[model samples]
Target chain A: MKTTTVFTIGRQFGSGGRSVGRRLAEKLEIPFYDRELIALAAKESGLSETLFENADEKATSSLFYSMVMGTYPLGGGAIAGRSEMPLNDQLFLIQSKTIHALAEKGSCVIVGRCADYVLRDLPNVLNIFIHARMPERIKRAIENYGEDEKKAESVCIKKDKQRANFYNYYSDRKWDQSETYDLTLDSGVLGLEGSVDLIIAYDEMFRKTEGKKRMVST
Target chain B: MKTTTVFTIGRQFGSGGRSVGRRLAEKLEIPFYDRELIALAAKESGLSETLFENADEKATSSLFYSMVMGTYPLGGGAIAGRSEMPLNDQLFLIQSKTIHALAEKGSCVIVGRCADYVLRDLPNVLNIFIHARMPERIKRAIENYGEDEKKAESVCIKKDKQRANFYNYYSDRKWDQSETYDLTLDSGVLGLEGSVDLIIAYDEMFRKTEGKKRMVST
Candidate 1:
């Protein structure tokens, strides 16, 4: 079987990004994994599903610093106590393994869960972040949840903030920040299907170019 | 006549970025401006068109920072023995006027001249940056110019560095940096036509959403 490229999507809640990812995977004939990754990680790590799920895409306290010699200054030792949490390390390990497994299985679309950072240095991975205007996302949430505008608005804000917090904690970069991803799409404006089509075309082109590079080197 | 949104494209020479900008304008049925901008700036500034044309999107010391200091760093007192050139400052002023005038006239596409930074705070401006991989850009240049691969590659590298240097000098920001533009497209991967289509769609969506924002606010 030919080695396939893996696409990992990080999205804001209510942005229809998930649906876009799903459609993209279906169109490309690849597997789409979202929360399903938790189960896979659980099986691989021999930990309860919720252990991975509960920590799902949450940020851990990985302090930002550069070490001179061995000692860290500026209250670093004290903070290391809080940062050295066992649960966070275990969760990160699971997330990392799950991402690796998904890629190993061939082409797959993995949504959120620090998938981008987890597989950053991998040879054939495409990382994308999706976002949209506040109002559009709020409207989508209201429609999807069949709830009133205010409740849906709160849900949108809360969920996006959670994603941002998680991304900031684990990645050396910020979440939903366009610079972090190879491709960043305003899914709300691109319309779900159009974005999916664009990404598929982009990924195909990228892989073809990569193949040419390998052939030239050989 | 209705006002249409203006798009400013910044690109590197030999990147086929200029062709992409032209195709985009044609596809959108909007006027495309590149060298044409030089004529307009000359007319606006009451300077000889040749002077402005020769300067031609070249970098000058950043006015943004100098303005904060309440004086032009280069223009201010330096030495009595050495005479300084005011040519760039004049060109910059002229180009800025031309940009505003063009925006006022109707929707149009302006290529380079740091149009993104020129129209940075404008209400309905779309800024795009076009780039390509080194090998791809060199290939395009070779095909177009009938140059050897090595020569074409050197030309591509030299031209892009000049553009980057110019942009960074004037904007105090890195050139070809993805975060600076509303959209960044790889011309090599997307191809000129695909990029044009994608951008047209993006521009349309942006306008529709901006229209909706107005409707909601009013």
Candidate 2:
């Protein structure tokens, strides 16, 4: 069987990044996992959805992550209760496992959750980042949430910052830095459909390039 | 007679900012000046156009600007052969005079060269900064110049840096900072016509708000 390809999308909030990803997945006949990942991870871990949802796309908590990493058992032997494991760590473990499971299952488009880092070593993976200008983001936020202009603008900045911090903490990369991704699209310029088209076109090119490499290697 | 409102645009090169401004001016039945600002400034100063053009939108080299006001002179005496003024100083003077002249003359859209800072104190002036995401800017540069993709990408970064430096050196605010303008829109998101529509809407709001203020005062 041909190896399935997974696409991970990192995006600025309100940039229609999710919409683009959804359309791309539909057009390419791949599964699209977004908030659904949290549910699946929760089910897999037998944990409440909120625990996974709260820690979704976020790195291990800074207050305790360093402490745990420093003192926790490098091998097995857990000391005690669930609280000792740290909420973020449990969430991360479940999410990491779920990502591997999903990739093993089939090709999919994963939005956020630092999936790019979780599956970085995978051969048939493509990572993409999406961003738009402040005005464009604000406009989209207003349209999406019926927010007042000022509130919409604030939400746009806050969401992007959260996403950036999440990506940066988990990955060996500066989120939105543009260098690490297989492709980065400004959804503001292309809009949702256009962005989807661009990604599809890029995927075709990438596959062709990979095929050429395989032929050379063999 | 009513004072004419001029829309001054500051832009990164290869962003199609100039095209947006020119098209906007045409739609509004107003003059749009980019390169023409240099010629006009040169005509006004009786100096060679190259002097003004070379110094365009760069930091002012004069000691006064470097040490103090952080702006070029609007209307002033140029001491001939004064050890050759610094590049920044020449740029400052040219930008200042060019901005003031355009404002004093009538309604016009002056593209780039710090027209925003030069006419900040003036009434009925609209200043806009145009920007796009790295990918979009790179695409535009590649399409417009028929250059290699990598080369176009580098040019986009270089031009944005130049504009950012130029704007920062002269203005207290960041170049693309939304607070500096009455309205900020991403031309790439709104597209050319949408951008023009946004500006017109803002202009209408400005007049209505000003009218209300006048009524309240009386």
- Which is the leading candidate under TM-score? 1
lDDT of 1 by residue, A74-142 (tens): 234332343344465656765687788778878899999888778766667767776665677778888
Q: What is the C-alpha lDDT of each candidate?
A: 0.68, 0.67
Per-residue lDDT of candidate 2, residues B121-214 (tens digit): 6656666666554566677788887878869877877777777787888776677544344334444434556556556554544443331111
Per-residue lDDT tens digits of candidate 1, residues B95-162? 88788888778888998887777776566777777766566667778888777876887787777777
lDDT of 1 at B14: 67
- Residue A51 displacement in candidate 2 (angstroms): 0.8
Query: How close is chain A of candidate 2 to the true chain A, as a TM-score?
Result: 0.84
Off by over 4 Å in 2: A1-3, A60-85, A146-149, A211-218, B1-86, B89-218
Number of backbone clashes in candidate 1: 0
Model 1 spans > 4 angstroms off? A1-3, A62-85, A145-148, A151-158, A211-218, B1-6, B10-39, B45-97, B100-108, B111-182, B186-218
* A135-175: candidate 2 lDDT, tens digit per residue: 76777788887878878878877877788787787676677
